[model samples]
Target: MLWIPATLAAAAAQTARNATQRRLTETIGTAGATQVRFLYGFPFALVFLSIALTLSGERLPRPDGGFFAFVVAGAVAQILATALMLAAMRERSFAVVTAYVKTEPVQTALVGLLILSDPVTPGGLAAILVATAGVIVMSGVGRGAGASWRPALLGLAAGAFFALSAIGFRGAILALDSGGTLIRASTTLAWGLGLQTLILTAWLLALDRPALTGSLRAWRPSIAAGFLGALASQFWFLGFALTTAANVRTLALVEVLMAQAVSRRLFAQGTSGREWLGLVLVTGGVGALLWFHA
Candidate 1:
């Protein structure tokens, strides 16, 4: 399915974005780094929406109350999730935090089922559990620095928020009355970014002016992070448009593997034998998911 490739692309871009934001967080603080994604990313999202509209030859989908509600919920939840994710990264290795966040698929499956009526077949549920187990294994739960409960809790909280965001975004996409999948997904991405940018901008301006100004002063790297963030969100929304959020999120667990690469290259973190074993499980679980969905 198109969603498969879209999810993969999203995962790759997101890993890059996370690496960039991780660097930014050191200088700008967590709030500033969090807002960098939305503020810088909003314009790029507009560009993506325009391209999708032109390619699809579709008008902008008119939003009703349902669209606004869903988009707002997604926007807020994602803001919280990003902040928590970055905070957790401050305490743990990049790969570990990535593995922690990958736990969202199960939460996403449940939330998507309850909130959006998105069904998860028994096979899909089993695959999700297996993939999630791989994440726990990779994270080396109860071992080493990762055993610290503070970062673990932050990561888990981030996963829960991410789950809510995925469900909200999928609901928003499905709520659209007109336009093809590409256009609808693009439209939703634009709205979600706009809302997030506004909310974070206001918060920064009001309470964290230094962090806000810090992000502005680092415009060069901020632009790079923004582009990557927008790229990730574009494909993520595309996947959500094509299938249930659970399927998209489960496929997205591949990001942990990608993040491991980033961690080794950028953070100088090495994988253990246990992590390698977990890698096989993640691969198997993702393979099983793809087969089941197919």
Candidate 2:
């Protein structure tokens, strides 16, 4: 299959994962929910990474100093981003949270350009602006008079952390000297997930022992969320390995549409006019980017 289709599938899977996460949050609370997902998902990630390594017939390489640091940083950033996102979800509508999350593409591109020194064409810049405008519209930024800026600010922070995580993971993958792509990708994912589990687990225990204990006691629902989260991360890593972070992040905007569908069905709310317009703009922007790049 083409990369586009694969990316679309990944985006769809990510959307489903987000919906599951949102549901998980309702029962476990945001922090507790995240702790459960990461803690439970850690083992699954190890298993999947091991399976990928075995199938590829590649030996895992010992990560160098830089590689280790990158993975650890990425894992930490992802954990922070997820925590912020879940918090935002608790405070805002699903549509609002998703629209903010879609800003990941823009943040990723900018970070890649500045930090990684990735080259950007004029067309790419234009696409970024258009997509950003779409996100602002979808967010109802100025329309909600007296609406607190907390959600938007929190969402943006989450997106920024997510961008950092993406950059960190990609850096780790590139730092690996392993000849096998599958092995390198899997190894990076394993380390990242492992680090995330450790850090988040420690943080939860230190600050919120009761929530952590509650989540552990009610492990049934958390198991599914954990499994789905691990599965989604695997696909996300695969896509990142195959394409530039900018491209993958841009395509991942499909998650917003998927989230919208879920919100409509599960939450029984239609999109606002601004959100509909924003969706159109975002679609146009994404199409423009794809066409220009192609």
Candidate 3:
């Protein structure tokens, strides 16, 4: 029951953040908007981390060499994922893109089992299969929206990167021996976000000065989106620490339904029959996971 509400709240918050990101993407382009999210939000995360450290009376852990390496690897994977996802957003609906991204739960579970040696039960595998089918249904694989294989491929790559990011953060959390749960999670998030900011800022400056300059000029909106993104990530990291990454990410699929709602209200895009079916499948899959875990 505790996991139920916590997961639902995280999912809701993430959906709102993604909606803000989608709006920013429209104005600045995906890559530029992602850079804005990290650059503008880094300070807020730093402030939060500082407060957390002070209150907890804990010094930042000296991350093990391997831990820092994992963090960098995760950061790189996330950057690549964000780039691909932004590009995919140009050609795909937010709902479709998000639905595809939810496949990360499956990928993460597999990677966790293979690399981290996390065990998976039969029920978990069943839930993953159901959820994957829902993603396929929502993707309009056979229906005609002029959807090509390219967007799906990019979305899958995004999911893979997201899986790597999860594993990296989890590894970091395991490495830390100091601080309470909240403090540890917050510290890891601060470093991860900080690394992402550095990498993305450099990437933007090198490849697209105009977009970076434009994003800076639109600081008001950019900052708002950035704050939401940071806050959303904070909750997500906490959830990751408390639960299995597979479970947390599987529940995060609710973001797709939330995105669909946003599209209907904000863009006047109605949900299609196929999308409704997909929703039913996704809901059932989530229910199954919860039931089995319970």
Candidate 4:
């Protein structure tokens, strides 16, 4: 399905965005870096909307009350999730934190089921479980002491928020009264980024002017991060428009391998044999999901 390639592309773009955001976090602080994805990304999202509209020759879909509710909820939840993810990045190796956040697929399935009535067949449920178990294996849950657990807590918390955000986003896409999949998905991307930008901008202006300023001073890299973020979100929304949030997110687990490659190449972090085993499981689970979907 189209969703397969869309999800894969989203995963690749997201990996790049996450790497950029992690670098930005060192100088901008977590929330500051988090806002970069929305603030700098919003303009690109608008561009994506324009291109989608022009190409599809579709008018923007009229948002219903349900759309507003879902989009707002999605926007806010994603903000919290990104902040937590950056915080977790500060605590652990980039790959490890990513593995922790990858747990969101299972959580997304549950939340999507509860909030949006998205159904998961038995095979899909099994695939989700297997994939999640791989993430748990890669997370090294029982390792370390004292503050070592902090990253795990933060990452899992981020995963939970990310799950909620995914459900909200999928629901928002479904709420549109008209427009083809591309138009609806792009429009929702614009709305979500717009809300996130406003919310983060207001917070930075009120609470942390310096971090906001820092992001601006580093705008060169911020723009790159923003573009990647927008690109990723656009594809993610397209995938959501085509399938259940669970399916989209479960397929996105490929991001774990992408992150691992980045970690090894960029961060010089090595993956243990156990982690390789986990990767196998994750791949198998994703393959199973695809087969079940087919």
Candidate 5:
């Protein structure tokens, strides 16, 4: 379905947006860089919502307490996940960090079942486990020059929060009582980004004024990254509205291969034999998931 391609597009956009944000982190610092996505993304999210409303002729759904709970949970968990990931980046290589965060498929399944009552088929569960094992094999846990548990802890925490964010966003999207999936997804995006913008802006203003100014000075690239971030989130929410969060997340394991391809093309890096094997396993697992589910 469209959710499959939509999720694929989100993964690619997220990779590109993160590359831009990595450069931003060097200038504005991590927290400020994280804020850029919210600050700049909110306007684009509003635009998306406006377009969806006009096209669908749907009024905004009246949000209930569950909607607010889910949205706030998604917003706060994502922010914390970003922060922890940035912190882990300081301690681990990008490959290791991403692999750690990729554990979200398993966690997402558990969270979705627990909180949203989303059910996973037996085949789907098998695919998730196989893909997760491949990801762990690819992580190269001891391949680092020197290792510490700090980054590992941070990475796992980031993965858990990310899982929470996925469940929360899916919950938020499903909580809507009216509108098409597109309209509901767009509406959730608008509210989520708006709340995140307010929260991060207030924090930056109170504690990190210089970083805010630095982001302002680098507005050109910041806006580019921000726009891409919003674009990715839009499609992500749409995917959530269309399918279970666990399925969306399991398919998203493709991003690991995407990141490797990006690094090879842009940074003159290459994967090893073990990584290739891992790629094979992940591909096989994901292929089986789609095949069985189809």
Candidate 6:
């Protein structure tokens, strides 16, 4: 499926966005940096939606209760997930934090099965496990860092919330029968970001004006991160629309590899032999997944 490429591109773009956002988080609070992805990103998402509609010549699918329910759930869950991730990052090392977050693929698979009735074959299940193993190792779960309940629970909860967000968005897109997959994905992205922006803006207006102002003041970097955030999400939605959320998220584990490469090239960090082994397993798992689909 074209979702394979889409997922790969999303992973790379998302890694860049994460790096940008991480820097921004140092200047602005985590909430503000997190809000940037939704607030500034909505405009780019709108642009994507426009292009998709223009190319497909499809009318905007009117949102019914089911559509809004899913979108709203996804939006809220996504925000909570970000907050939890920020909190986890504060409490633990990046590798430990990411190890917890990487649990999302497995959680996504289970949630997709239970809520979306998406089925995975035994081979598909095996592929997911293999890929997840690679991701866990890459995340430094092998470092044995989940020692405390606080950070561990925070990370696990964040992963679950992220899983819920994926499932919600996937359900929302599939509920829209009036458009092509591109149209469906774009529409979902636009609405989800819009809702997230509104909610986060309202929160900042009421409670943390400085963080909000800080985000606005840091417009240049914020915009770059926002644009990439939107771009990554656009492709993420496309993949979700084309296949099961489990499959999409499983392949999405390669994001860690992409980020690791960036660290190596940009930060001069070295990868260990174990990391290379993890990469090989991820590659093999991806091949197995593709074969299973075929």
lDDT for each candidate structure: 0.93, 0.79, 0.78, 0.94, 0.86, 0.84
TM-score of each: 0.98, 0.94, 0.93, 0.99, 0.95, 0.91
Q: Per-residue alpha-carbon lDDT of model 2 for 135-224, expressed as tens digits?
A: 888998756656547888888899889899988888888888874666777778778878877887788889988778878876887787
For candidate 2, the 10 contiguous residues with the lowest summed lDDT are 1-10
Clashes of 1: 0
User: Which wins on lDDT, candidate 3 or candidate 4?
Assistant: 4
Q: Please tell me which predicted candidate would have the highest TM-score against the true structure.
A: 4
Q: 229, model 2: CA deviation in Å? A: 1.3
What is candidate 1's lDDT per residue for 72-157, written digit by digit as tens? 99999999999999999998899988888889999999888898888899998998999999988987768756349788889989
* Model 6: residue 116 alpha-carbon error in angstroms: 1.0
- Over 1-294, each residue of candidate 3 has an lDDT whose tens digit, in order, gives 454566677677667766676777888888777787678878888888888888888888777777787778777787787777777766788788877777798889988888777777899779877977887798776566555777888888898998998888877766677667678778787888899999887878899887788789889988887787677777777776676777777877777788899878876777888989998888888888888889
Cα shift from native, residue 134, model 1 (Å)? 0.8
Q: For residue 183, what is the lDDT in candidate 3? A: 81
lDDT of 6 by residue, 1-294 (tens): 899999999988888887777678779978899899888999999999999999999999877889999999999999998878767766665544555676787789898999899998899999988877775665554355446667777777888999999999999998886888999999999999999999999999999999999999999999998999999999999999999998888888777667667666655667777767777777778778889987
Q: Is 2 or 4 the stronger prediction by lDDT?
A: 4
Query: What ranking emerges by lDDT with the best candidate at the front?
Result: 4, 1, 5, 6, 2, 3
Residue 194 displacement in candidate 5 (angstroms)? 0.7
- Indicate the worst ten consecutive residues by lDDT in candidate 5: 139-148
Off by over 4 Å in 5: 142-148
Model 1 ranges with Cα > 4 A deviation: 144-147
219-244 per-residue lDDT for model 5 (tens digits): 99989988998999999999999999
Model 4, 237: alpha-carbon shift in Å? 0.2
Model 3 misplacement above 4 A: 1-6, 145-147
User: What is the TM-score (0 to 1) of candidate 2?
Assistant: 0.94
TM-score of 3: 0.93
